[model samples]
Target: MTETITGLHDVADRFDAFLIDQFGVLRDGAGPYPQAPAELKKLRALGKKIIILSNSGKRSVENSVRLAKLGFDEACWDWFLTSGETAWRMMAAETDGGARKRCLLISRDGDTSPLDGLDYNRTEDADTADIVLIAASEGDRYDLGHYQTLLQPAAERGLRCLCTNPDKVMLTADGKAFGAGRIADLYEELGGAVTWIGKPFPDIYDQAKIFLGAIPPRRICAIGDSVEHDIAGARMAGIASILVETGIHAEASPTERAALFALHEAAPDFILPDFRL
Candidate 1:
């Protein structure tokens, strides 16, 4: 509701574009925020080039369906890209140009549709995979054992651990949900390393902004909750960041807030007291 612009607006205004985060900024996983739809709609009327860069691995089509179901109209922005889609592309690119490779994935039940051609394998087949990829898959049966016995091998052998979503958890309409960040954490705890190919990372931001087709990164306004990822990522990318204090660490203690602010050395330009938009 306030027009407080950042001093770096000159350099950050290049794209006139926006690459918004999903969970904390726009809505809490439960349903669309009361003011998010309107905020986006107003931005659209202002002719902002926008892209929904979600960490969900199923790609933008899935986001298209989910966003609408969550009350976000496609007309509000120009593009929508997901970490799932980005993860798939990264895997496909790393695979042998000719030889087919197997993949051991922990995906949701109905979410395996995007991973069509790649060979599917179980956790036991960890050694066979050219890459170890993790997404926000079905977690009903997912336990620490699977990682300890199966996926650990893939990571131990130095196979690339790719995380589609780098978020540890999110409170959706149903309840709190675990994403690839948790899985990645498990692997890391087991002495495995990974490369998150999407947001909070620069590569995804560059790709999505470029995909906005002529839009510059400075023109984009980044919004989200995770100071470690969203806010820090925006600072590194030199874009304006808006912090929504309505999810994740919303009830942060004073020490927590200090650590969050100190994590980046730079503070957010805008802070939404609640996830209203």
Candidate 2:
């Protein structure tokens, strides 16, 4: 029963701030959407506060750089928040309390920025690691089976996995690819415990609320493409939501989209064909 709309301007006056998703809503990994920058500028001109709520495994600074590189105006958004930044802050704040944990990181292209200033020791062997950090997926290079084999040792040892990105699929230059969340799911299937640290989770929303100052939850809206993450997260956070059909669910048929909504047990207040002005 979601109302269909053309773009953000349709509901511009209904909200004071927006928690916008980055990956599928703003860009497709390779470039930004054609109307995205203009849409952002329009929202900014309307005196709306904008925050990029991304489930990326990279830090906020990295995301901001990427956005700028993609031709987005830096003045469009007031703040940028990513699950990786949230996880990094949490990890950095942890006091080893005399027992430093050994971490085995699984990130795209071996990026270790998540652990750059952390106290956890990095390990190359899963058998020697105390916890598994599923920050990003190398889906473009390896298959899910590759991860299953790589993580079996850690799973056998009952190591906990901290998944910074909870996206099940990532948009690639070619098409959809496996995401870090899928890898975390595999670890759970292999009997390893996983701690999700991204969208659809309360921690990230709580942090977004802090950044939003005293904006009432009822006056804020979240826009994203994933039913499981964006829409569901908004429901859990007690805010309005808008579903964009330009990201993970871009190609979903009517029946498939219905199934997804039912499966997630959540629906957006409004739906848009894409993120536009």
- Residue-level lDDT of model 2, residues 60-125, one tens digit each, is 989898899899988888889999999999888775677777899999887888888777878878
Model 2 CA deviation exceeding 4 Å by range: 97-100
Least well predicted 10-residue stretch by lDDT in candidate 1: 1-10
lDDT of each: 0.69, 0.90
lDDT (tens digit, per residue) of candidate 1 on 1-277 = 2233332232233447767778777777677779878777866675667787677767777788888888888888666788777777766675665655566676666456457655443443887776677776444456657656777777678777778877777565666666668888888887788888666788777777567776555566776777877777788887777776767768887478668779767567666665332
State in Å the error of residue 231, model 2.
0.5
Please give the lDDT score for candidate 2.
Answer: 0.90
- RMSD to native, candidate 2: 1.3
Error of 2 at 54 (Å): 0.7
* Count of clashes in candidate 2: 0
